[model samples]
Target: MNILGLIVEYNPFHNGHLYHLTKSRQTTNATHTVAIMSGNFLQRGEPALFDKYTRAEIAIKNGVDLVIELPTMFACQSAEFFAHGAITTLNSLNCIDSICFGSEEGNVDILYTISKILVNEPDEFKASLRKYLDEGMLYPTARSLALFDYINKFNLLDISKEKLLSILNSSNNILGLEYMKCLLKLKSNIKPFTISRVSASYNSENIDSNICSATAIRKSLKDYNNLSLIKNVVPSPTYDILENKLINNFEPMFDDKYFDLIKSIVIRENNLLDKYFDVNEGIENKIYQNVFTSSTLNDLQLSVKSKRYTLTKIKRTLNNILLGITKEDMNIVKDITSIPYVRILAFNDKGREIIKAIKNNSDINIINKFSKTSFSMNDKVFKTLIDYDIKTSNMYNLVYYKNNQHLLKGPMDYYISPFYVKNMCFKK
Candidate 1:
């Protein structure tokens, strides 16, 4: 059976996502489509609009056969680490034939070329990068300048600086390059495919087209309780779910809402800031000092932002602090070089077949629920990794308490079951 693998956030499934899903299945002509999706938190260093189980259920109801959770630790990281962890998980499945992702350029050839440069890191490019870094340029700007210099000097490809800049500026293209780099670095067998994004740009915050950016949809949802305009950009099924969620006051989790809790965590870890993952270059002190007076996540980020650190970077670091994901924890998992387990969020009948295939064909543990798992892993290591996921879920569930009955009592990790969507209907 040809199985297509996809990486998704689906913060709230929309028309753009639906198009990508439909095209992915058609392009691969695959029997099954499996998605590795972000859990509660997303790559953008924010909690998802809806919970993971709800999002996964929507995915399966639309087209995805199975949805597996990307560990929160990796999901809320930078592009490189996020791609590395996601690609690693997809590769671990051992049955996927291809991995399809959406890109602004949709040119796998160019993406692959960029990936080669990133993977190989030619001497001249590295020197240029170092020179720009020494000049105190932000990492992203410095890397872009370095690549521009090296590419032009060597005449690597028949491309222009402006075109390259456009490519780099496109967030989807950047992620597509990272995905390609991961596959090349790992020498994995799964083929990579790209689908071009249409209409709205990645960061666009207004819905002006049928295929609108998720950012736009989210912003609209928050500013206006009405879904009339949003209905244009998302599938009817997704729209219905979103409408219901809005009616119940279950949405738009602005990061600043957890400011008090995040501040407490940051202040508590002041002396031990070095322990937190991604709080490098003495950024811990900045966060520690800022946490004292910063009232909101936005305030903290603005107070801590600098030439070297973007707001997104600061937010991610703060998120790590909130989850208590230490550098030591990251190192422990990195040392093992493999995820301890894969958690299934939602699936259909086709997904049941895929699970059976996984059991018979792969060695990695598949967790439908905590109690149902029977895998032999070092107790300490297993707990360490799973703790981050549980904590992230509990934190996200806190935001959805109005709609989520299970979370009202306590954390919903154990009580939550793998959602099953049958006949395009969502089931808890």
Candidate 2:
């Protein structure tokens, strides 16, 4: 009954993901695996290449037994919040034995060490962090410098500054660190494991190898408009499903698709743009000022970008505006210790058993079929979270199925059932 948990976006299931999945299961010898996946929007502040349901189906088909949607509120957020939501969801399951992630630095011990320091934030570290922040460096860059300064001054680990910086600067490693930090923050008992990422880096656009990054795969699709170009990098099911969708005229979404909508919102809500989450420190002014001249999402982001705010951060803010996720909404759930519900996206036969186990072992609600009256309407936190999830799904559907009006039914979440894969066979 050992269950392994994975946190993933799986924008398009690829060979790298397949390898990580196989190795993680082998390493843990788990009987069941569950993944907490991002929905339509991803942490990188972009809509997924394919929607969540398609991605979840591909995940189950590939190997994972079950896939649960990470709430939209957390899906399009920073690493800390994203990890917090994911780890908390898995923790709520109450049956997970271990959680595995792939990282540039494969050593869990090293990542754990860094996570502890970050979670504790000692006096010296905090002082160093403040100093770097005061210097107007990006948060990630400042944190990296502060971490190195604190670690070097105290002679914490026998690692060079260059090596530590390399570890801190990597995308996967940053996520891995946040995962560990969240695990510690929750005092969860699930063991953590990490496997070294092979070949291409996280943001690498080179597709020379079979195990290239998801970025590379997406780049190939964007450049050539052909799935066959990435045939070598992704699994068979990924290729088949994506190809089928394309053949049926299902256009994959990119960030730019919502540029006009975002610009309009920025203009209409110019005075009160600060109400949205992460639209702080007068960044709203920059966004509003640029909206009139910015032609694309990229142009707006670049116009709003500064040393203090990264492109990704600006994109996340823009998405928050589009989703109408207000800071007040975040405040209402600030003290929410656990996820209100576990929403299943896709599952296999083995996943049914896991669901039963969850029902027996945990008290959290499991949402297999969403309806307006399924949960308590009196609960403000619950309402807020569920409303955002439904709203984001509708918005994603609006853009995704705009060309095909027939598919744009009202509130897709209420009618959609968790995708089921009968007689599932694990891919080798």
Candidate 3:
């Protein structure tokens, strides 16, 4: 019963994901696989192309046995928090053998070394990091430079500064480092494995091959409004699900979809924007100032983006505001040692077995149904986390089903059940 865990945001399952899934299982020689995936919103603070259930179903159809929702509070956050939520959730399962991730630098040893330095945070590294921050460098930029500085100054490893910078600069490498960092912090038994990312880069915008980035796929869909344009890049099941959504006129959701709503909220909460998570250091003022002049979400984000605030951070802040997630809410959950519950999104026959394994081996709560009675209402932290998941799902559904207003009668999360696939056969 070797179970492999993966942290993912399979916004739309594609060929690259298929390769990683197959290779990861082969590398770990695992009997089953579980994925902790982002819900309605993604880390980049954009709405998913399709809803969570649809994406989860595609994951099952492709290869993964079970898909658990990475709670909204963590899904739409920075790399550290996102990795913390995902790594902690997998650890809580208490049955995972190893966790696998895809990265440009496929060497686990190098990633592990970087993670150790980050987790330990030596005095010299801290001093250098602070120096960079004080110099007005963006946090990510500062951190990367600081890492290079610390390693170069101490001659920690035999690696060159150029090689180290290259590793830190790659998005997947950075994320993989975060995963290892969390694993070390928890002292979890789950071993980490990495596979080299093939073909397109993480943010590549053009479809050059069958394994192009999800960004390229989404860009094609957004630009052409045609599913066939991405038919070659994604697995057949993914294409089918996407085509179905297109046929139903439930066009893929994007950040721009919420522009009007965001604008309205910014206006209504102008003075109150400081209450939202990530809306600190007078960023609320920039948002309020930009909302009136910006016609689209991208425009507003660009307007608000500065040396201190990256585009992704700005977007996350706006999303936090839209979702009504407060800094206080983040503060409450910040110290939570483990995820309060594991919410199943979709699963197959093997998934059921995994669930049973979790129940027998772990005390973590398993949420298959979204009813109020399933969780402890008395637990404020649990309530806060679960409420955000429910709120984000309902919000996504409201926008997704905008054309079919009749479907918005009640909260969709309560009515939706974790999708079940009878057969566990992986589709090639």
Candidate 4:
């Protein structure tokens, strides 16, 4: 009954992901592992390298017992919201014992202390954060500076300022911190564990070793068609799935397709940009003007990015526009019910047991099927949230078709059943 939960994108499950998966089980003595992964879109405002079902199947083949879909509403959001959604889903499962994540620092104690500070923001801390925001710094940078300033001014913890800075500086550690923050905010009993990342640098495109970052793997796939270079870096199952897609002329989703879609949306609805989620502070005008001139996704992102908003932020906002996710949608989801439904993507036998346990104990609704009639008895929020997931899948499939006209696999979310893997390791 010792189930370990992980929140992941698995955007083409690589060697580094495998290492973390094995280490997580070993360290926690977990009998089962559950992964709540992003649907087609990712937090970085890009579509996954492969479809969600393929990624979920790979996760099950590797070692994970269960795979659940983190809805597109949260998947394509900022780090805090993404962490909040994943943690909330795992908590709703009512079966997970602990949640483990990879961090650059690999120190849960430091992360825990910082999480407390975030959850229990004192007056001085709030003032410092407000000061930084007034100074025109972006929220992420401003928050980091504010934390650094507050911790030193009040001697918050025993950790040094330099050490604290390093924790915030690392991307994985920042995510790990957010996970801890959410867990504490929810007052959940699930323990937190951090596994040191062994991959190449977070976003480094240079692949010199067997383990490389997902960013680098995607770059390699786009820049070179040679699958041999990454064979050693990804597990056998991952390699097979990716190779099959590539061989079938169904390449990874390129950003240009998404950018073109966004461009069309922005140009046609230029006056309605403010209605899109995260397209505030006059960013819509920048997007509208730049979409006409930019030829590539990178060009559009760079043109719209400024000190106030990072490139990733701009891309995430654009993703919201493409999906027609408005600020009102986010507010309703967040303020009313953060997680409305728990949806299964892929599972094995052990996962089935977990699902049964969840069904018996969980307070949230469970979704194993994706048809319109499936929501006939559900709440309006469930329909609203699930609709976003459906739209994301439809859009992802459209982009897939644009990339591979001949290898068209029709949208499977609505018609296909949750992927079930026969027990390959257990012989009866």
lDDT of 3 by residue, 1-428 (tens): 88999999997899999999999999999889999999999999889999999999999999899999998999999888889889989998999999999999999988998899999999989999999999998887788888888777877767877788799888999889989998999999999999999999999998988999999998988999888999999999999988887887788999899888888899998889998988999999999988999978889999989878889899999999988889899998865668778999999999999999999999988988777445546788788999999888887887899887776768888888999999777632
Q: TM-score for each prediction?
A: 0.91, 0.94, 0.95, 0.93
> What C-alpha root-mean-square deviation, in Å, does candidate 2 show against the real structure?
2.1
Stretches of candidate 2 off by over 4 Å are 123-156, 372-375
| lDDT of candidate 2 over 1-428, digit per residue (tens) | 88999999998899999999999998888889999999999898889988899999999989899999998888899888888889989998899999999999999888888898999999999999899899998787788888888788888877787888899878889899988988888899899999999999889999998899999888888888888899999999898999888887788888898888898888888898999999999999888888888877888899989977888899899999988989999888654668878889999999998999999989988888787346555878778888888888888888888767887668888888899999786742
lDDT rank order: 3, 2, 4, 1
Top candidate when judged by TM-score against the true structure: 3
Which residue pairs show backbone clashes in model 2?
none
Model 1 misses residue 419 by how many Å?
A: 1.2
Q: State the lDDT of candidate 1 residue by residue for 1-428, as single tens digits.
A: 78889999997899899888888878887788899999988898888888888888888877888999998878999898898889888887778899889998888888887788888999999999999999998887888888888888988778887898899988889889988888888788889999898888888998887888899988887778567878788888787776777777676676776787887777776788778889899898888887778767788899999977888898888888877888988876653445667999999887887788777778888887876654355566667778888888888777668565654766677778899876543211
lDDT of 4 by residue, 1-428 (tens): 78899999998798899888888988888888889999999999888888888889999988788999998888989888898889988987887899889998887887887888889987888899999999998786787887888777877667676777788878899889889988888888889999898858788888889998988888887888677778988999989988887777776876666777888898899988899888889989888888888889899999988987789899899889988888888876763324768778899998988888887877777777776446675576677788899888999888776656655546567676788988745211
**Each candidate's lDDT (Cα)?**
0.83, 0.88, 0.90, 0.84
Model 3 C-alpha lDDT versus the unseen true structure = 0.90
Error of 1 at 22 (Å): 1.3
> Of 1 and 3, which scores higher on TM-score?
3
What's the lDDT for residue 160 in model 1? Answer: 85
lDDT of 2 at 292: 89
